[model samples]
Target: MLTISAWKRFLIWVVIATGLIFALPNGFYTRVERHNDALAEIEQLGATPARQEAVAAWPNWMPATLVNLGLDLRGGAHLLAEVNVTEVYADRLDGMWPEVRDALRDARDQVGTIRRIESDPDVLALRISQPENMARALEIVRALAQPVVTLTGAGARDIVVAGENDVITVRLTEQEQAATDDRTMKQSVEIIRRRVDEVGTREPTIQRQGADRILIQVPGIGSAGELKELIGTTAQLTFHPVVGRTADAAQRPGARQVIYPSIDEPGVFYIMEQTPVVTGEELVDAQPSFDQNGRPAVSFRFNPSGARKFGDYTAENIGSPFAIVLDEEVISAPVIQSHIPGGSGIITGQFGVEESTNLAVLLRAGALPAGMTFLEERTIGPELGQDSINAGRIASIVAFSGVLVFMALSYGLFGIFANIALILNVGLLFGLLSMIGATLTLPGIAGIVLTIGMAVDANVLVFERIREELKTARGPARAIELGYEKALSAIVDANITTFIISVILFTLGSGPVRGFSITLGLGIMTSVFTAIFVTRLFVVMWFERRRPKTIEV
Candidate 1:
């Protein structure tokens, strides 16, 4: 009865061996992590001698991954930002002005001449020459409205058109606002993630907090200010046709054009068309490079649609100056020297090497849908993180040693087998963590130490069951089999209940709490496996080899 088939024995040993193999790299975590990073860099930049040597520092055949340390463990910057979703509403309304003008122009005889009027920042207002024809104008503009595609939007339109007196007002409807908010938040999170990843930090957490706020935690970043500076620039790059150059800052160039001062020259200003031919959203790639004058600059390539539009505009507007605007400021106004057919161009400005590189990174990450205001920011130092790690390490070692000694003293040789299984259980836990690239925090360490005590509970239950069965009229093999059989129900019930709790914590909790839940949940699984399968296989092998007639409890 206390026997295992050949296949079962192989499976049991294979699991142990696999766990050991994966767990081995964690013992040399720093070396393995550096090796992995070096290999990645080499692959990206083409294999170089130095990088090849760095990769050789750790063998290629070995497991290269290590459990990522969390912000609490590694020390980093934390920021809570609120996105200005309302600003996007204003921009969306402003963008529709051109289309509204063209649509109303078609029925000029009925709607009369339309002139833009200053109104609320979030509303588009237009004054019609003929007061009685305001309804006709509103009807033409409302035809441009599209249904909001969000679940909450239902049948509502994206824009609401209303006419009062001679003024036609356009504003984003409630449904559209809800949809915009969702898109803005998702875009903000994604852009923030891209910006952070560009700096090559490991495992940064960028998540949405409420409806309009974002929580960013980037490990290994020195300060919150640094993190803010990296992602703060809206980086809204656009190419607009230059209407004319102006020296006066106060000069208003109608509603269709804007006046912006030159970055290189303080006194000079450029009046550029508000509507851009192509925006950075269409850019496929951007990189830092040097211009003809050896000045730091950024070169960008547009996507196919953008390229065709850009090429057509440049070919038609040869010899006309075009403004390269960055965040509403004019970077440069370069005249088209020839019929530029390619979608690629260079942005030349007063930039240092670092500034040019930063610009390239921001452009590549894409623009945030809306601006963000930092509500809270803080930085955790590496010293504090190191102290936490040291404390956790000491605690784990103490708990593990005490448990090992107690189990050995309590059950003699049988207890030693449990101890062996316990060590393997921990090894298996780390193996899974590393393989999955889970982040481990201080709370996670507590979870591991807690697991050590619980790991032995299963063995204790079976050992007690065997002692009870020995008192009955039964041989060693029959008693052992019955012991395992009786303990199985209690083991399953206890572990399953605990595993369910871990799942709940993981689902509901954030950050550190989730980390704790992960280790605790993983511990529950590994402990059960080593306890029932690994420990029993050891006992079965020993019993079969010795042909024991009797055994002491």
Candidate 2:
């Protein structure tokens, strides 16, 4: 039997646990009282009741309740995207391989080519079959290729004649080269984050997985379907010459104006072109809504230099046309209506919500940092998440009940007492979760349920220790003390090992797995507290009431 001191220790432990678990998210009776004085003051100035209602409905005054829901429970879009370095390299080969082309051209010019010349940005392959001319060809090609990538497909005339026509593909070392790996994946993650934020997703969690992937979680998303539409669009932008829109417009026989190609209208059109000498990069900000005349329009502000340049350009070409060319298509080429020298202008078009959103996404992410391609995407519905939550709750109830019944039957009154500790252990777990403001995903709830079974393991250790000691002829008080002392090492070592694994998991695991580890870690500490104090106190009190004690654990 535990002494009076033992009972006091148990009660203090319980009280401490309750305070941490229960009294935290808000104080015991603390309410979030909203101050309405500002609203009342605003109402005093309101011109009409309708206007006051609009002011009251603004999100700034309301504290939004944003709960993080599990991927399965809350329903969301899951996407997997891979960086295609092959395509990037291919593009480099197509547009920027001037050195390779020049090498082939110079090789041809020097060697007097009778065959074909095919050169990509990264590789130059040709069929200079004349044996006498091959030596000069290799020398010219060797002089031009970047170091570590030179004259690969080379050999004797016999080797060439047998099967090899001059065809060589150059590749760089993995670390020294650009490819779809962790670094590229991380870049893609940042770009995607920028894109999602451009669409106004607050508090999005975007992260990279390995060398070639990203995981994104967007909470309280309203534009999920729009996200699906945009997943694979590689809308990277760069500044190119406006190609003399003013000249084109002045040359135009009619008043049709030029514009650029974008999601708003992705096709070229013939207009009186008045191309701005400056490109879109000069734009500092874009606001979308109805124009002064109530038509959908985008208002753009320019940098200081851009403003001055705009003023100068418009001043010079007062009667000229300026075209807004995007992706090589003109959306609108309104005649430079009296020169927008202020550097700010409006893009008025037949735009709806979808087109406006796409335009906003473009202006916000700032012409994509690089091109992207989607390699994976999955849409999750809320129904699936609801089903999973329902199943988890049922399983928890069944698992918890089984634990209570087994502990009670096996240990009699002592088992029943441990059962109460078990109940308190679970209550404290949720209370802690609620207090910490931690999200309870389905996996997290299951982790708590599993913790219940493990919680009893510590008490079972103590109970069996006492039974063993009493059987060995110790007095009740001595047996109880020895039992607790002997059980301490085993209990701690076991829980500590489990807790270590949980820590490792929380550090290394992703998403839901981390949730499991977090709850498991919390469980270990709480289980030890409940087992050491409450169970021992119950045994001590029971001995005082019954007075006879001898049993097999």
Candidate 3:
């Protein structure tokens, strides 16, 4: 009566074989990793002879997916950075100056001549020549205010306008500021993630810590300094119409004008409009290429909206110099010879090939919404990671060996069958991990060790029930059948509860805790299958062949 159907037995062995095959790559981690990296490079940059040889290191027909190592196991760079969200307020005010000027000019007869005055970075102050027209100026500026677009900021205006005497000031409201801070934080996290992904590092964690702080952990990077260099550059590129060139650093520009020194020329500065014709935010693509003179450069293309604005600006400003600014410095001021219809352009400066390539990468990833100041930085060395791995390896082996010895001593032939199933259970766990591309941390290793011990509980339960069942007059087959049937409910109940806890941990926790939960959840599924199906199948096969009238579990 205790028997597995032919199809069921076939299905069980097939699953076991597939799992072991998928898990085989981890046995040769170094070679398989090189093969994977080489394949990625070939897909991205085309193949070289060396890359082809590396790809051949692993056969194409075999499974190549690997379980990623977490930062704790692989060593990496960690950084805590605080974003300068307030900086966007100044930029917002600067951009609003043109609209404010246009609105007030429409009422020039009432407000008289308007001029910008020196004020705080967060405020836009305007002075009118007519003292009695202050109310009129305030009304015009207040009319330009729009409702904030965020859900919590409903019914709140984005800008607040106030006036005293002949001066009117405009600044963002409190609700608007809060909304802007939220947007800034989200954008910063995404941009940082994009930059890290561009470098192809494994399993980097980029998450917001608090209101204006971010936490970054990148595995397999050389140092925190290297990671900072990769993501730190603002790479804020803009094009503005040049007002004039000057060498006097102390010279003040009129309203709506800014001065920036040339990057290549010493002591030379260019005064330019504060408003840009187009910004890097509108860029859709950028690539490293050679300019007309065969010098290294970065070629960029804009989205549709940006293309129209760029084309119109170039068409109207022929023969005028346009300054290309990067991070408040003028990279070049080239004269527009004719109307350029296309949205594509090249940035030429003092750049090497590597510089151009890196620039292209940054441009494609988009500029950070605001600047960041690093608060804490640390680099974990690989030697520490190797020691951790060695310790985990020893722990897993000890746990596995101890479990095998105990099971063999207690239950004779049935114990041996349980031991075999336990080994397969571990193999199946690793296979599932590889298939899902889960990251393995030190805590994850501990979870696997715990799983090895827990794997035998179901077998022990079934074997004990069989021992009691043998006391009756019923034969070995009936006792075995009843033992498995009776123990099924307890096995499912216990494992299901633990699996739910693992799911909760994964949902609520982060970093190493998540790694542990993933391994534990997977181990539960694999262990249950081996204990119930695999061990039972082994016993049934032996009984069918030998047909022993008397048996001992």
Candidate 4:
């Protein structure tokens, strides 16, 4: 009953030793983190003496991963923003105007001449020259409708077209609006995450809250305002053909053009076509660099189609000015000196080095689908997080010491075996956490303490079962075998039930609740393995080595 194969013994020790090796790095977490960060920087920006020194501080062969601290344990910013999904509805209508015009012009003989009329931004109104052909006009516009492809809006039209007298009104169908909202939220989350990651934060949480909201929490950030500035920029970069320069702000060139003030020159405005020759959507990469005049600038490259369009426009419009607009402000309107065949160009303005880098980051991350209004903001201080870490440390020490003493006093030598297993179990837990890069928070520390108390329950049950068998006149070895055999069911049932509870908590909870669930769940698995397997191995080794004819459990 106490026998163990050499292979199994080797495998068990291998796992324990591997876990200890991985957990060792956490003892020097600050140094390891610095080393890792230095390595990443070197990879990104090339090697420097300081970075090389930092990388050399920690060996590459050693485990470099550390447990990521959660927002509660690290100073950071938190924000809850509501994405304005309704804004996309107006944009959708504006984009459909060209298509609608083309469709009506194709059927002009049947519907007569069509003229766009003023209405709400979310609604398209067109006046038909022929009033009697209203039904025919409706039929022609309705043919442009497409089915909404979503679970909630399946089989529903994307647009609804209606006509009364000589006027026709167009609006997005309810189902299409719902689908658009979902897509907008998803795009917003991704863009926000990309923007946050570009700054090289350790771990940022960018997630959707509901139908039209997003929750962002980034550890190690200074304040909510800083985070808002990082992801809040619409960064709608567009290159438009400059019609002319004018001092009059009231001058209206055409319905399809607008005027914007110059960034460098005050009191001067440039009237440019509303339709952009190229937009940031086609940009594949952007980086901060210096212009010919040694000033800070952002260099960008466009995709194939964007490059082709840009080349054609530049070749045809040489010696003409085109304005580079960002957030409705013209950065600079420069004349095309030559035909640039490649998709690459430089954007220059009165920008500092930091501004140039930030612009590059934004261009690389792409633009937000729609604007967001922050509903809540918070900035957690590092002092509070330090206090929390200190408190958690003291609590863990107290709980661990108490558990060790109680076990030793209760079961003597056998209890010492359980204590040793318990120590290794904690090591294994940290090992797994580091390997997975799990985030640890205050509640996660509590989960570890709870695990310490529960880890010995199976041992206690087994020891009690052995004592009962001894009273029945069984031999020590036989009593031990029967003890482990009979206690297996109870141990499995109890741990399985607790594991299920952990799963349910993880599923329903967020933030700190989730951190606690991760540790609790991981601790359960490690404790069961150490208690049943490692402790049993120790007990069997003691029994076989001593060959005790009569002994205590």
Candidate 5:
């Protein structure tokens, strides 16, 4: 008999119900989106009357997951930025200065006096008073060279040291530069992702394009310029010892001192020591809070090592002004009133609540490894996205309606069963997408249209086989059973090959290609299930009830 067991029949309906339930939220996308947003805000900021009303827009018992709309379908900001990895070379050489100076100082009896010379940003040049001792200085600097950590750079020293006529120059080796560039790009991508996530945007695409370029696509952002402002701030915070205050911007701060303008005060600058006591890299946490004066401020805590250094510096430098520098500008230069032992500090400045909150976010996300130059930027409008959505909906409807009509006409009653299965197949596809939190793009819609066409292939094969079996004078039940058994191998073989291709596409492709692959891959699984199991179940149930003596294809 072509009857499904009780457990199998029950399982099939349960699956179909679950899929439809999960997919239900998409039908009321706006209401459910508002509900989800309200819920998240309630969890983060506590509920208000407006938020509570929004939350009540959708029922709490239903599945709240909705497929994330891609950049093309939702409108967003797009940017292609080239990271200045070479900037790190200058910072690396500057950090190496103290070590180099200390090493050369050990041989001062032979080397005489050494002074750092103004040179190219990537090169650290030093002039020694004694010309003949240059060999000794070179040896000391070369001894400080560490082996590069990368696979291709193994056994190679990170720095190249050379001397000529009393001047010694140091620079990063080519292999080390390559390794540093790679690290810089990876760090840039991660930091950009964190900054964008801080804004609570959905499914952002922050990916590396080439060697030093990054592509960022953020859905629902106002503009590319706004996005650039959010991620471009380096937020390089450092606690430097203030040398003196200055009014003249052109004032020359002697060697090893930098002059930075005060952020809040006009026409005032602070001369700061080049070496910082602590940097934002040591910061463990930062949050927006009110200072003692009840003004908006950012509160920060340092890690243990930073805490120790900060505590010692404050303890010794009481009554002296300490420069709180961000991106080379002194934001605050407050006198150390007393020893602060706990490593916690508040940054008070001319800021509103929003500015303080954004500052806290930037500090928490950490500084970008280097600066980036925007190579390309674009802002897509929601009106354009809505147009794309309307076009895709029309295309999908046309395809779906055409498929339903064609299937019904060709296979008669069996074709109606196939059409019902095809409908369920689309529902199941959306259910899977919602469950996985997949982003749906325009190409993904095309995949759905393709799936609707392919969904009836198995049913067509089975019905044609049954037509052949009926001609052999086989009983209706036996013919239906043999038809499914014969069609099973062909269905699995065809879908399996296509599924493998989708997997490969997903593995290698990015952006829209990835979106298409995800939908196609999921569509294949649902289509096969509906075509074989779902349509067969409908046929068996109808036949069992009607007890048809003869059936027409």
Candidate 6:
């Protein structure tokens, strides 16, 4: 408010300073361990121009190495898997021997106790009779750890173990393969995260949603379909039938492999391989290369134990057909012509660079426990993402300039104050995004554009009010005071409602939508501060110099 010009000046300067720090981007002002790692990797590869530029820029000018982009702007993929919570419950119950023992004891006594025990979304112990078996039931309940199966007994008496039972209760009661508690679901999310990392989409965002669902965002993904194919398949490796291949076939199917249904890609080739004369699961690492036949192949070497296993398998399976299937496709079905017992082997197939790299990553990680399916599919091509980013940047500059010219032209000399505030408002928005590490998507850029207009509008509101007060012949300071007091409520009310909507969007939306909401919301706050405090500070300095009774609006 004009009531405290000195305080306003201090606050505006502070906001501007803080925003500058944030706007610089992490590592821009300082180099760290991350810069070294990237440089090392680039140098080791004998950096191409692009890679060299990335290293030269280091923490500044370069995009953040770990900077996570929203799925839309960066062009990535999302995959959701249905976790097998049934196995988890079974395993947990197996481990909960003491509690199970106590519950069974109560039931055996024919007293009021846990009658039936079934575990589905959440672990449960059903109450049987009453008073008689109550002692054993109490004992069973006592034996459970606090984080153990959320006790939902079918009796009149109950207790809340935690503040929110919603996270641990039998909310969706019927799915055996599903998990309902925070612990199990969180565990599943962690596992999925590990699995996605192995898939080798760098800096992917994997998090849990609700109790059972997982949210995964993989940025800079080239093939959304392929990622869906790779991640959606649980890659649950097992020995199975590929009856199509005969050891003495007239011609081999490129390499000896069988096709099964892919869990990730429906109707796609799944590897029907149980008979691994050698398994990559045993391989410590794999590198891609072209074989002697000029065909793309992956070269892998096994550990000592794996070497022994491979040597034995090949020796035993001599003259038998061994297949190598991946994600259900029979890439090769090479026959064991003889006992070629080496710890190292090559997988030659229809391999492009990405396909080989992805397969190598997956094989290096070991198999998953179950199949997975995609709940949603989204694709953002590289060309399109770049175009959008360019458009957004151009639009922001244009919109901002337009706001500046309009404010200055309409308000005359005072509009200069509005322009200065508007520019600071932008810097503050960038600073906030950098500090908070919020992703910036194309939609978020639009939010920034909108914020520029709003910042100018807030200044206009204040200036108009000041001009009106000046009409009553108030002194310069008094006119400014009246202006701020009147405009404060309208500015706060309008921005607060918008902020609430932004909060809702952030809370309910996923991936890019959340990014947009965060940027938009930050923009609103920054705009309000810049316009109210910053512009008012400029007005104070102006009034002190000119002592004008009326200001142009």
TM-score of each: 0.95, 0.62, 0.95, 0.94, 0.96, 0.58
Give the C-alpha lDDT of model 2.
Answer: 0.61
Evaluate all candidate structures by whole-model CA lDDT and list the values in order: 0.90, 0.61, 0.93, 0.90, 0.93, 0.62
In model 5, the runs with Cα more than 4 Å from the true position are 106-112, 129-136
lDDT for 419 (candidate 1):
91
Native-structure RMSD, model 6: 11.7
The window of 10 residues in a row where model 4 has the poorest summed lDDT is 249-258
lDDT by residue (55-118, candidate 5, tens digit) is 9999898999999998899999999999999999998898899889998888999898889998
RMSD (CA, angstroms), candidate 3: 2.0
lDDT of 4 by residue, 204-315 (tens): 8778887899999999999999999999999878899999899887877776678999998888899987768888889999999999999999999999988998999999
- Go through the candidates in order and give the clash count of each: 0, 22, 0, 0, 0, 21
Over 4 Å off in model 1, which ranges?
Answer: 46-50, 247-256, 292-296, 338-342
**Segments in model 4 whose C-alpha atoms lie over 4 Å from true places:** 248-256, 275-277, 308-320, 336-343
Residue 183, candidate 2: C-alpha displacement in angstroms? 4.2
What C-alpha lDDT, on a 0 to 100 scale, does residue 292 get in candidate 6?
93
> Which is the winner by TM-score between candidate 2 and candidate 3?
3
Residue clash pairs of candidate 3: none
In model 1, the worst 10-residue window by lDDT is 42-51
Candidate 2 matches the true fold with a TM-score of: 0.62
Model 3 per-residue lDDT tens digits across residues 394-447: 999999999999999999899999999999999999999999999999999999
Residue range with the least summed lDDT across 10 consecutive positions in model 5: 131-140
